[model samples]
Each structure stands twice: as C-alpha cells, then as structure tokens.
Target: MAGGGIDTRVSHRAASYEYKVTRYLIFSCIVGAVGGALFGYDLGVSGGVTSMDDFLVKFFPLVYERKHSHLKETDYCKYDNQILTLFTSSLYFAALVITFAASHLTRKKGRKASIIVGALSFLVGAIINASAQNIAMLIIGRILLGAGIGFGNQAVPLYLSEMSPAKIRGAVNQLFQFTTCAGILVANLINYFTDKVHPHGWRISLGLAALPAILMLIGGIVCPETPNSLVEQGKLEEARRVLKRVRGTDNVEAEFQDLIDASKEAQAVKDPFRNLLKRKYRPQFVIGALCIPAFQQLTGNNSILFYAPVIFQTLGFGSSSSLISSLVSSSALIVGTLVSMALVDRFGRRGFFIEAGSEMIVYMVAVAAVLAKYFGHGEELSIPIAAILVAAIFLFVFAYGRSWGPLGWLVPSELFPLEIRSSAQSVVVCVNMIFTALVAQLFLASLCHLKYGIFLLFACLIVIMCTVVYFFLPETKRVPIEEIYLLFENHWFWKNYVGQRHQDTLAEPEKLGESKPAHA
Candidate 1:
C-alpha cells in the first residue's frame, strides 16, 4: 500500500544535521513574525471600535439607537446588523481573493516581497481609515487591510518555517502567533483609554494600525530570503551563502545538496497548482489545505476576539470597562502562546492539540452553562455570573492560543512540499479567510438567535476538529521541512495514497504495508 509503482526517497535530513540558535536566524524570524501584528491589530481593534458608542452612532446609527433601547430581547440582538458586521467581515472577503496573487508573488518574487506589499497596503489602509468620515471609506479601508493580511498570512508562516532549523521550528514559527496576540493586547489597551476620550478615540485606535505596518515594513527590508526560496530562484551560490550563514557553518553541504535536489524536483513540476490536485497529495490537500485552517476558525475563538468588548458591554460594562475586560482575555492569549513556545517542542504538536481541544470543550460548556443559568430573556446577569462567564472564556482563549490559534498556521505550513508550498499556503489562507469571513458575518446574528447555545455550537465544532486531528494529522515536531513527506508516507491511513501519483522520482519504494496502525 505504500506504493503503486512510485519511487520513495525517505530523508534523514533531521537526523543528519543539527542546528544551533544563531543571531541571524533570530533576527530574520523576528522580522518575519512582525507580519502577525498587522493581522492581530485589526482583529483586536475592529471589535473594540465597533463597540464604541461614538463609532456606532456615526457609522451605524440603527444599531446605535437599538443599543439604548433597553428592551427585554435586545441584549444579544442590539448589534446584529448585517451591514454593521460587514465592517469586520469585509476584510476577509478581500483577503481570500488577493491571496492567490500573493501565492504567485511568494513563489516567484519571494516571501519578503509579499510581506512588504502587505505592510505597504496596510499602512495606506490605516491612513484612510483614520481619516474616513463615511461608511464607504471605512469599508474600502478594511478591504485594503484585508489585502495586507492576505499577503502577510500567506508568507509569514512559510518564511518562518523555511528559515528555521527543524529542532526549534515550532517556537520560531510561533513568533508570528505571539506577535499577533501582542498586537491584539496593545490594541485592547489603546481602545481601553481611547474609548474614554469620546468622539475621536476610535480614530486614534484605527490610526495606530500604521505602527505594526511600519514595523513589518522595516523587517521586510532587514530579513534575508529563506535558503529554500533562494535555491528555488536558481541562485545556488546565494542559496549556499545564506544557508551557510543561517546555519552558522561552512559544513552545510548535506543540507545544500538536499536543497539542490529538492529544487530539481520542484522545477520538474510545470504547474504546482495543477500538481497539487494529484492523488498522491490527497492527505495533505484534505487535512492541511482544507480542514485545519477552516476548523481553526470554526473553533470560534475569533468570535470572542472580535466581539469581546461587545459581549462585555451586553453584560453591563461601559465601553471602557468592556475594552479592559477584553484586555484581560487578550493577556491570557499571550500567556498561552508563551506556554506553547516553552513546551510545544518537548510535548509535541498532537499532544498539545488534543489536550487543548479537551480543555476548550470544557471551558466552552462551562461558559454556556453559566450564561444559560443566569442570563435570560428578561433577566439581568449578576456581577458574580458575569465574572464567571469572563473567567471561563479567558481559559477558553488560553486553550485556543496554545493549540489552534498557532497550530492552524504552523501545521499547514508543515504539510506542503516546496514545489506547491505557495499554492498550498494560498489555499490555507483562502479557506481560513472564507470561514473567518463567514464567522465574522454570522456571529452577531447567530448570537442574537442562539444566545448561550452559540457557545455550545462552537464546542461541537471543537469535538469534530479534535477527532479529525486525531485520526488524520500526524505529529510533526522536529521534522525537517525537506523530510515531512515521510510522516505522510508512513502514516497509517495516509500511506495508501502518498506516492501513488508522484511523477518526479525513480527509486524503489519502501517495503509495503509497514505503516503504523491507526491508533499509533
């Protein structure tokens, strides 16, 4: 089952070479990871600004008046306008579309090009948003911001993964996630104070988006291209030089040779996008390109992130206090990310996923139970109950931070071959964006209709996602990017299809039927 007349070249790259933490590697990764702030600032900023009374009154007066209605059924339904939700969801719609172009840019022009473009676009969008007086301008600005995110999301994870040695790849790549959380925290802190300033506070929150864009713009200029990318462009001497520098050694022949061979394999495939559709890649396509990113959004952590201030407002806090409440939750996200960075390499990816998934389920249920018991059609929630609700959600956010929030990006970046990496990353971002857009578009409406049951819906999604990860995703810790093929090739269910359609290799297949059992 391991082969159907297809050659298999298993790599011992990870075992053959070891890497030390080098200054260049750290600098490049930090620069690349700054891309996450562009994404995180928007996530944290949009929700807070939307919940600002002045912002809603100016841009969405219908929802604004409803917020003051004080009607029995208005608690969850106050901000449920479709057009209002568009302010948040519109960014993703634009991101999903632009990511295809970013894919080509990433593969042909290099990852840094896309990151630079993203930062530039975001900087402009921030300027427009800060000055906008109409809803049209705000939406247009969001669309531009989405374009920035599309490019950033497409390039940053792959950049981090390619630049890193296998031993510390998780921590390196997760710098993107950590920076994203950091951006969110900063945005929340800004909003907490800005909300108190009235009419122009939201503008200050919106304009500061330019700061992270500036950071990444500087970073894009500073960071070196990944050795894999250099090799892909046929800059073999440059690739060798970069590889030597990044690895901190002249003894990089083994890795350099592997990169040459992989580049040869990559060149033979005329169109990677078309090649990605081959049967041999089914496992990667289904789980990595499709399921993981989509499911990450479906876990609904962003619902809390995007509407945390709003949810707290409904629980009886003013805009400032609600922003403060979200600040606490965002702080937990940073803590969880740090915990993951410390433990992920040691504990492995799948363990963190399974453990965190279970933890999220428990917290989701706890949140739902509390809301259902004390929050009702005409009832006001007590201080104790609201505190408990926020506490449960804080733990939920922490669980998500460790597992899905970062792993969604990390796992997909791990799944693809270099030849199709850009294409696959594009798909990952598109699917993630589509789901994210849907969630952003629907969450307010769903919250109004489903009430506490909305929490239970996310819990059910967590169950399905955890099951898929258990059955389909293999542990990828410490696996070299060049060698990830073996993980799929030897996987219990994936082995059946991994190499059956690959056309570029001509070695004897591994002994058949030697794959691990399903539960292994």
Candidate 2:
C-alpha cells in the first residue's frame, strides 16, 4: 500500500512539474513575440504614415503644393524626396548607436532588464511621434524608436535561444520573425483604416505602436530570467530553477552543468572580440557575424519592403493600386515567414539557405528580364506584363522571408557561447543596421541609374551566397549550446558534409559537457 501511494505521488509530481514548465515556456515566447511585433509595427507604420496625404501637407507644404499642382489631390502624400528618405532611414542611424549600448546593458543587468528598457524606450518614442509638431520632433521620436529596437532585437533572440530546448530552438527563435510579420500585417491593416481620417490620421498610425511596447514591458516583468544569464552571473541555484521551469522537466541537472562548464570557458576569455578573431573561432565569426547579415541585406529584401509602393508605381501602377499591391506583397511575406517558422526546425538551416538562395536568384533574374523587356518596348507595358513583374518581386520576398529573414537572427544567436553572445550579437545587429541603412539610402538612386540592372546585381549576390553556404555553413539543428564549437573545429568540407549526422550521434545518451573528437 505504501509503494502504491508513493507511485501515485510521483506521477502527480511529474504532471504538476510539466504543467508549470509548459506554462512558463508559453509565457516567455509570448513576451518575445511582443518585442517582435513592436519591431514590425515600426517598420510598417513609417511607410504608410509618411505616405499619407494629410501627413505630407502638414509637414511639407511646399512639396505637397508642387506635387498637387501636377495632378488631382489623392490619398497619398507627396513630400520632398530627400526629406522623406531622411525620415525613413534616420531610425537605422540611431539603431546603430544604441546597439553598442545594448550589448553592455544585456551583460550588466541581464537580458530581461535590457528588454524592459527597450519596451520603455519604444513607448516614449511612440508618444513623442504621436504628438510631434514638426519634422524635427518626428526625427527625434524615430531615433528613440531605433534605440528601443536596438535593445530588444539583441536581447529577445538571446533570451529565447537560452530558454528554449535545443530540439525546438530554431522554431522558437523563428517566432521573432513570425511576430515581426504579424506586426507588419497589423500595422498595414491599421493604416488602411486610419488613412481615411484626415489631418491627424498619421498620428493614430504612429501612436498605435505603443500598445505592443507596453505589452512587452509588462511581459518582461512577468517572465523569468534566462538560465544562461543566471549561470553567467554565478547564480547556480537560480539557473537550475529557471532551466527546470523552461525545459519542462526536473531532469535539468545535466543541462545546468553544461551551462556551468560553458560559462567557465566563456569567462576565461577576457576580450571576446579579440578572441573571436582567433583561428579556432574564425569559421563561426565569418559565417555568423559577417556573412549571414551581409548576405541578408544584400539580397535586396529590405529594399523591396521599404520601397514597395515606389517600385510598384515605377512599374506604372496608380498610387492607390501601388499601395494595395504593396499590402498584398507584405501579406505574402507574412505567409512565407509563417512557413519558415514551421519548417526551420525540421528542414535544418543550411537546406533553407541553399533553397532560398537558389529561388531568389531565379526570381530576381526573371524580374530583371521582364523589366528589361518592358523598357525595351519604349512604351508603357500592358497590365498583364506589369502583373508578372509584381509576381516576380513577391516571389523574391517570399524566398527571403523563408530563409535569411529569420536565419540571420537565429544563426548569430546560436553561434556564440554565453560569455560573448550578447556582445557578438550586438555587433552583428550593428552591421545589419549599417547595411540596411546603406541599402535604404541607395535603393532609389540605384533604381534611377541601374534600372533593371539592380535585380541582376542581387541575383549575382545570391549565386555567391549559395556557394558560400554549400562550402562553409554546417547544419546546427538540435546541437546543444556548448558543443557548437565542435562544428567549427572540423575540416570545412567534412563539417558541411557530415556535420548533422555527427551531431545527432553525439546527442544520443545526451551527456552534458562531453567533448567529441575534434575531427569527428
């Protein structure tokens, strides 16, 4: 009878433990999603708000008058192209500066604190933007918004990676990308309605971003700190508690010990950047820090997203039609991101990169061919031809959303050890923003000068990127955080060919901190 009662108690305890873990994991992912949604909202809102007729008339009367003199007043605004460009790209400049600070903030206060700071920053920015009386005020708000993005972008992915089980880490991290798409969809929908409100409609569009920011702040308060950060801070017991809560089981001893071992190795390195350059870690730095983000930006995805309406108009669509088409393209992006979230874990990262790269090359080449043919005609093309061009652009976006959009963020988050994860991620984020700024600044100029050549340029880049992935990038699916170094240690070709199988073999009987043979 005593044995029977003890068995029942054990079963009950196991059930109760699982309940808590599942609850905590869901809560944490929701919090990360809030941060992602805010990021997406910022991206979507700016495009629509700046293009609103009332917004331009209030802010730039001279340019608005010039534009209106040429045609009937319409729903879209016209502003000085230079000023409008500044307004849109200004956020990335600020993001670059604040990302440096975010690295320190994440390390000193912990990832949760950094996330809270980001949420508050975004809230303040939203308020300022909503009440802006001049272009200068609007610019200041954008700066603040960029700062918030800088903080949250670095902290959230790192937190998610640390908290997630290895088996589902890719899917969980991809949630960041998925929520970003959701934010874009939400913002686009809001702006569609708000555009009808004259004079102050832009304010409503910009102000709505605060809702997600507020939710992120509240969620940050409720979520537990990541176990990895706790271990870094030498709070072993706290780390164990967090691991148990997040991993959904009490059998976290091995994982916690792995964290301790990895933490010690990370702490032993005094200068992460200097150490990152060492020959041993070069492959990771090359692939994670530099190549991934550089290739992601160069793909022209952001250029397409930031200037979709303009591109559509250049293709001869009317203003309203261009806006609607941009919305549809953004919807495709959301769908592609959702698909990526579902498949990233199952398909593995390298496969997606290769597939997406190949598809992007095909789509961009086709777009260039179609555009070249239209321009060759020396007259306006028929609507069917224009539709083909739009389809090509949408396909390019779909391919990007499926691969680089999420993996760019996911790869860096998983590549580094705990000691340098935040700093390394911040550096990569800064690089990403820099490239993004460059692309934003140059995209219109490229359209003017290169014409269809721009698509060809992006296509060539894909060819190079695909080659790099096939040669250097290894599969990291289900690999434990500590053992990631083994992936970089093997010969490049061997790692690429047999890396996943080796990782799977090592993962069996999951011994924590167990080192595989260097050549294995």
Q: What is the C-alpha lDDT of each candidate?
A: 0.83, 0.75
Q: Count the backbone clashes (under 3 Å) in each candidate.
A: 0, 0
**Global Cα RMSD, each model:** 3.7, 7.5
In candidate 2, residue 210 scores what lDDT? 91
- lDDT digits (tens) for residues 354-449 of candidate 1: 899999999999988887877756556777877888788899999999889888887788777767776777788889999999999999999999
Model 2, span 1-520: residue lDDT tens = 1100112232233333332347778888898899889998888777777656788788867755644443322112233266666677888888888898898888777899999999999999999999999999998998899889989988897787777765566677888888898887778777777878877888999999999999999988888999888988888898898788777778766667666766776677688777666555566778888888888899898877777765665565665676777787788888888878878767877888899889999999998898777653334458899788878877888888889888887777777755566557767898899998788777766766677898999999889988887777767766555456556545445345324434333333234222233223
Q: Candidate 1, overall lDDT?
A: 0.83
Model 2 TM-score, all chains together? 0.84
For candidate 1, the 10 contiguous residues with the lowest summed lDDT are 506-515
**Candidate 2 off by > 4 Å:** 1-21, 61-80, 247-251, 375-381, 417-420, 478-481, 492-520
* Overall local distance difference test of candidate 2: 0.75
Residue 104 CA displacement from its true place in model 2, Å: 1.0
